[model samples]
Target: MTMEIGLNLFSVFKELNEDYFGTLEKVAEMGYKNLELITVNFSTCERYTDTFSLPVIMKKFEDLGLKAFSAHEGVAPGSVIIDADWDRIIEENAELGCQSIVFPMAFISGREDTLQTAEHLNLIGKKCKEAGLSFYYHNHAHEFRRIGETSLFDLLAENTDPSLVKFELDLVWVMRGGYDPLTLLEKLGERCDMVHQKDLGMHVNPVNLFTATPQGTNLDTMKIYTEFVKPNDFVNLGTGIVNFQETYQKLRQLGYIRYAIVENEGQLGIKFTSIESDLKVMEKYVQGL
Candidate 1:
């Protein structure tokens, strides 16, 4: 199956907060038919939906010809987690016509934390399945921290149920973690249900994040590591070092992978122009596929 170009709303977060409908219209006009909605804040449970109800949101998406294909959820204060109103969250996402509910990120310190997170994910995934929606776990560079020769991500993969849980692999994070995304893709195969495409600028020193920063998974350590990742470290889709052609080809070969989502991060100042450039590059890649 040919993969479609999609956008993660986090790209234009500032614009969305300022003018929700206007930002979305611009996105649709730029040819993004599918979207991965950022429903909740990473640090807090403040939901964008709290400002607008489900029906209103659905109507807007329908009117614009945009599909809410996936959504990001997490454990924030008052946010949708395993303990907090998860059933309602699932019902609401289903009502919004979302195909999948994704747990965006986690802070893991060690093997136990990783395993526990995986167990919780299994529970969430089971619930999502019963509600007729797929569940996915999105990764950051922290998931690649070594634990007994194996990465935390590997441990999570081992602990989670294949039938219940899948992954939305972020290529930039995989590279930042000092691993080859293509090789990781080979290992993940069909379990990688989606991909977040971004590129590393040519000027990024050491290239691998783990190389310069110490391997620590705590929040403070993570923040310290983030400080090392400058805004310029990220470039538009095909302008940097990532191999988009191979990535698209690999996803097409996998046959089950769906959206190759455009994740325009670290370019907030020019989010509109960045995504437009990304779409041009993505179009070529998809055509090749």
Candidate 2:
């Protein structure tokens, strides 16, 4: 369970409560030693500003004797969403001292051109490698969706140059996809670099039939995601659903020394104290496992 715990500041993402410093302080208080940050201000597609907030924010972590090991960078919404000026994004990331650039995203349809995705990723990775920065992909459950007995993600992974595209494991989502996270991790081997320690409580909701239906023709919620995990985003580690203790134990047994980032996506809308309680529970459980 104790595998380099870090925090993603993008979680409590609202303009009103942009308490980046307070969030960092809270994470530091809870024994987290690393942080993953997001940089750039996206006012528009044609005209975006590089706030360079990461350098100053990263120093705050350094001041706390913590490492801002990885960053999410300018890639957003979709893992396969290739930026037109990918080099610019990479350059900005290098400027912030981001050791790794993580493409943590939901896979987009028609973006299933694995060859193109691989080319884009490989191109970026080559640059990052040359610049002494690593690159990775963080998965959501949709990455496991298949076409002709092979997943689009698998196709992308298999086709990509190993030296270029490393994986940033998101264990909970992997498990939710009905595949054992470790099995997939081992499948990729050393191409796997970092990890996202999002534990999906204890309940596996049986592939969720309702979420499988078309959006707008919906029966239930109108959350961020068109379908899948947006509804269940509130479930904290080892609590409502996923067996985090056993999962962490298995991960350790497999010799995966990656960061297990605790990301409470959309859970911030709830009681803050309750969220803190869940975090404590996760911390304790991870330590003992």
Candidate 3:
């Protein structure tokens, strides 16, 4: 299928609070036809699984004319994925009708940490494959740090099995990592199945591009990581420095057909006017493509 526009529920996590179903309803109403789920509360998952069941949750999405395309497992960095939990994870996502499961981020201190993260990814990716689901690793700016001549991201990509472990490239973070998004996209090629469509507003300081932050930092203190981000650094789709037109063109040329999830992480205390506005921006850009 040709790739379509979707919203990462994380963009509106704070606004929605713990209203998981309410968020889905609001997002669909806002004209987002697809969703990339982020687990804000583990209880929310249990509530759905225990009371409604996976099919019921899927039905809820169907009722609203929305598709749950993918979900972030939302595990913390450096945490081991126990083998026993693999079945539960796979089953939950399968029932949600997710085509892929993504490991959002991993805390890597150095070369050793990077290697350990890669091993964990491969292990999880293997189990995900056994359950008939694609597994992917989502990137942040920290992955751009070099271990030697190659980046940590390159190490993970090189070590993991491409068939089992694809990548979800976050464009904004790619720029923040001091690399051209297009160059990274070219490097990943077919291994890239999804891209996070976040825009960077003007006034970004390239000098602070590679500033590394420790992984698994408290969510409440996330704003500290945005110390380098200007007030307008995070923005909606077409309103910022990211060249969506050229990026989409490259994706098409590369025959990349995967979801483009609009993610506006409200870091630096910066918030978008509304999620609806963000969705509108993406819709207009995708239509033009």
TM-score of each: 0.92, 0.79, 0.86
Question: What order do candidates take by lDDT, descending?
Answer: 1, 3, 2
Relative to the true structure, candidate 3 reaches a TM of 0.86
In order, how many clashes per candidate? 0, 7, 0
Better of 2 and 3 by TM-score: 3
Candidate 3 overall Cα lDDT vs. reference? 0.74
Q: Is candidate 2 or candidate 3 better by lDDT?
A: 3
Q: What's the lDDT for residue 75 in model 3?
A: 58
What lDDT does each candidate get? 0.82, 0.62, 0.74
In the order shown, the candidates' Cα RMSDs to the true structure are: 2.5, 4.4, 4.0
Tens-place lDDT per residue, model 1, 224-284, is 4567777777788887877776777777777776788888876545789999888889888
Candidate 2 lDDT tens digits, 157-224: 88778888788877766765557877887787767746666545344464532345455213322231
- The most accurate candidate by TM-score is 1
